[model samples]
Target: MNDSQALGRISAVVSENDVVLFMKGTPQFPQCGFSAAIAKTLSQLGVPFTPVNVLDDHAVRQGIKDYSSWPTIPQLYVQGEFVGGCDIVHEMHQSGELAQLLRDKGLL
Candidate 1:
C-alpha cells in the first residue's frame, strides 16, 4: 500500500488502542536500544500496550516520522494522542508523571 494508506492503517491502530508503541521490533525483541529502554520503562510502570513493528513496513516507518514530526522510532501514543519518544518518556518517568499519565488513561 501507499504511504497514505499505510498511515491510515497506523492511525487506526493508534486510535483503537489505548497505548500504542510504534517501535523497531516487537516488545519482546526491540531492534533498537532506545526502543528496548522505553519498553522496559513502560513495563516497569505496569502499563499494557500495543507495539507496532515499523521494521515490517517501510511506508509506515517513514510515514510515522511525517505524522509525528518527531524524527524518531518507538513513538508512544496514549489515549490516541502522541506522547513523544524515549527521552520524553524517560523524563516523564523520572518526574513520576508517566505513571500518572498512564493512570489517567486507565492503561496501568
Candidate 2:
C-alpha cells in the first residue's frame, strides 16, 4: 500500500479496536525488546488488545510512526488515543498509572 493507503488503514485499525498495539510482532512473540516490554505490561494487566505486527508490513511500520508522530515502534492506542511506547508504558505501569488509565477507560 502507498503512504496514504497505509495511513488510512492505520486510522481504521485504531478506530476499530478499543486497545490497539502497533508493534514489531504479535503479543505472543514480540520481535523486539521494546515491543515485548509493552506487550508484557498489557498482558500482566489482563488487558485484551489487538496487536498489529508492523514487521509484517513495511508500509504499516513507517506509516504508524508518521500517524502518531512519535517516531517509535510498539505504539499503544487506548480507545483511539495515542498512549506511548515502552519506557513510558513501563513507567506508567510501575506508578500504577497505566492500570488506572485502563480502568478509567473501562478496558480493565
Q: Best candidate per lDDT, number? A: 2
Off by over 4 Å in 1: none
- Model 2 per-residue lDDT tens digits across residues 14-91: 999999999998888889999998988899899999999999889999999999999999899999999999889899
Clashes (N, CA, C under 3 Å) per candidate: 0, 0
User: What are the Cα lDDT values of the candidates?
Assistant: 0.90, 0.93
My TM-score estimates for the predictions, one after another, are 0.95, 0.97
Clashing pairs in model 2? none
Error of 1 at 14 (Å): 0.6
